[model samples]
Target: MTSNDTPEPTRPVTLWAGFIIMCVGMFMAILDIQVVATSLPTIQAAIGVAPDQMSWVQTAYLIAEVIAIPLTGFLTRAMTMRWLFVVAISVFSLASLGCALSNDFTSLIFWRVIQGFSGGTLIPGVFSAVFLLFPQNRQGIATTIAGVLAVLAPTVGPIVGGWITQTYSWHWLFLINLAPGIVCAVLAVWLLPRDRADPGAVRRLDFVSLILMALALATLEIALKEAPQRGWASPLVIGLAALSLVSGLAFVRRSLTAVHPVVELKTLMNRSFAIGCVLSFVLGIGLFGSVYLMPVFLAFVRGHGPLAIGTIMLVTGLAQLATAPVAVVMERRMDARLMTAMGFGLFALGLGLSAFQTSATDFEEMLWPQILRGVAIMLCLLPPTRLALGNLPPSQVPDASGLFNLMRNLGGAIGLALIDTVIYGRAPVLGREIVARLQAGDVETAQALGIPASVFASRIGQPADAGTAALLTPLVEKLALVQAINEAWAMIALLTLVALCSVPFARAQSIASPQLQAKAGH
Candidate 1:
């Protein structure tokens, strides 16, 4: 009954069952992250938190992730995967319950950080385990399935969140995690393989490297988060940036010397893997940057409500879900580099389409590009991930996957911080310029200038009844803000295109497992 290493790989029913359970866990984790975003206003009121302090819920989770990701490899080797998973899920689920029951923001944020640490376990473990479950030839398929979860979870998260937020209290968002978390934990105990941790691996932990990485990532994350509010040169911001630079350098030095490192620096030495990481960084910028920008744009510029904004993004999410199968099918035959290029290229094109938007642009106009973006994302994200780790030794898969995700997540943090700083910084200047050009009743200039003056006045800026002399000026200001945001999307598109260049260097290989061969042959 046991499918431990044998000459012929036996189908592990338990592995497939574990995959199913992990999918649910993945769904809950991603759903909570995004779903609660739309529900934040409601939660802030329910918990009586001020707007300035509300960000802690997300900050706590992200900080926890930063701390947990590098430790995953060491942890997996130190504790049996099954027991580790059980403990992680148990903590995450209980944290969810605590969140649902919490009466104040401080208490909620506390449980959220706890949830962050526990929830961090699902990704690398599920992905690495899935690779182990399938035979070698089917790794592409396994990875694809994993990719679908990656893409779909964030997409469906908001839709589910919207429905729950509208129907139940915001507490439901936190409560929802409990069911899946408990189920995933139980399944892990029942069907999952309990691979015991080797004691020899415990001695290999690079404590200094771990500290340096945590510090580097934490400082960088803090610097990025603060940039949007406190201009880049703010002393607090500048100091964190300096600390991040020093820590980043220290981590690199330690990783090279440490007998056992948190990250396998040699794996990154592969040209393809390194290049793939560059694209991943760019992909992170687009994926996460857009998630931050679009809703803000839609709500502030387009005058959409939380439900409406959620609905619009739900389209992109659905489109992404639709594209997953195609990516899965195509990766099997096509070189991953080509697929990565295609994805980035399409994403670039989609970004270009977004730049053309104005206050007059309607939902349909946005949908087409979203569809394209979704397809492009699947193309860009999956292949690079596949190529990045494909050439590494089988034993290195977990560590590589952890590093890959860590880099991408870090890229996302950078993107959000940078884009927000750029857009928010430029908005007032752009708004003033637009006002100068379009004065009210200057029909000749507005008509000849191709301004949607009426739409702008109604849709953008601080809503107000203005002086007759400046009646149409707000219209111009609104368009300018909208245009500025579009410009941001354009920047992301160009960045994604640039990321495509890295594809040429991706290594052309995949990890092999004999069990995979036996299953396929059977």
Candidate 2:
């Protein structure tokens, strides 16, 4: 039976119970990555991995997750959403336990792959339920819950990770997932209604397409991750990039023609859905980029610890929570396109404001921009999600949800790569220029850098003593790095503003299915 025709629980409690469970699963999954990121140094030391090899802990999970995301449509069809959630959460829980118990890097990486694959499905699964289970009127609130979890998990991950690692140990990061994973799994089985699995769908698994998709995404993620350190032109990076491109093209061609495609790329033909996907991609860039930029800045520029960084970042989350109700109200009453435009505009303003920051900038200086971003991220997410999947038929929802979510992740990957390029590429050049100006007797620059006139004169056209050069070197590097970071923030803002042009392409009205509207009316 189609999703609309499937029987839903008559009681509201049961429906929402199942949904909350799903959200719990999704929240845990997304939160896992960030929490691990915050505690990686400890993890690396404990696991005895080289500094260079340490990134694989996260990279392995990311590559696996990216590959699994697109396969959700097929998996949901084969196993049914209920069983899928049950199995995914069970595996995720088991994987978490395995990770916590791991004594070696190899075992940790293995468990992380399993954890990532299982966790990946939870993301699209939660989104698919908006149309599959909820009525049109309630979808705004439903979307709000999902969007909040989506935005909130990353926002608070560092805080939670910091507390766990600092107060207890790094193992708690994985051990913590055990309770929620089990609880979510049990709740799914008890609360979610069962649907018959499609045997035909299971039989039609496109192995070739799956392999190509996996290779494409895996290589792409690795390439992006390594490009910054290895140099984009390095043979390893170039080979991976070429492999990703070829595999990606093959996956696209195969999915288009295959009778039982893994992903539903054709959904992009719908103007609204297509625009929503674009918006999702751009939002990913801003959301993930900003999240990345903040912690690094606080850690390196300001020398804040993880707990402090996470605590300060809470401003954005608090702002998001405050604005969520407003987003819910607007989703019901306002033009999604207009709401989206407003969101991107405010988010850009926040990002642009952050671009002007100095090395000394702190909580007070960042408060307003954090509030703007906190409020704006929800606006950016809620409407675009509704616009993308609200109108798609049940059969299409899974595919569309997977692809839509995939865009956000892809945006994060691509955005970070570009941001890194800007930072690393520009910092040295700017550093040299600033040093040149200092040598050229720019009085204001000298005064601002706290360099004595005699010292400046001594350094002119000659290498100064180690003490003077040491002081000046660090100052120059800090200034140059901050400038580069500002450029990155500005670039993100411009990209966000550019996303505004696509808002007009989204349907102005809610496109929720008639059945959903009818159910809401009842």
Highest lDDT model number: 2
Angstrom error at residue 492, model 2: 1.0
In each prediction, how many residue pairs overlap at the backbone (N, C-alpha, C within less than 3 A)? 4, 0
**Tens-digit lDDT string for candidate 1 (159-195):** 6777888898888898887777778888778777656
Give the alpha carbon lDDT tens digit for every residue of 1-522 in model 2: 233345345478898899989998999999999999999999999989999998898889988888888888888887888989999999999999999999999999999999999999999989987777777788889889998998999999999999999999999999999988888888888888777677677677889998999999999999999998888999999999999999999999998998878887888899999999999999999999999999988988889999999999999999999999999988877878888899999999999999998778889999999999999999999889888987787889888999999999999999999899988999999899888898787866775566677766766677667887787898888888888999999999999999998898777775456576767533
lDDT of model 2 at residue 125?
Answer: 86
TM-score of 2: 0.95
List candidate 2 stretches off by more than 4 Å. 1-7, 447-463, 510-516, 519-522
Check candidate 2 and list the clashing pairs. none
Global CA lDDT computed for model 2: 0.88
Candidates' RMSD to native: 4.4, 2.2
**Ten consecutive residues with minimal summed lDDT in candidate 1?**
1-10
- Give the worst 10-residue stretch by lDDT in candidate 2: 1-10
Clashing residue pairs in candidate 1 are 135-516, 136-516, 456-475, 457-475
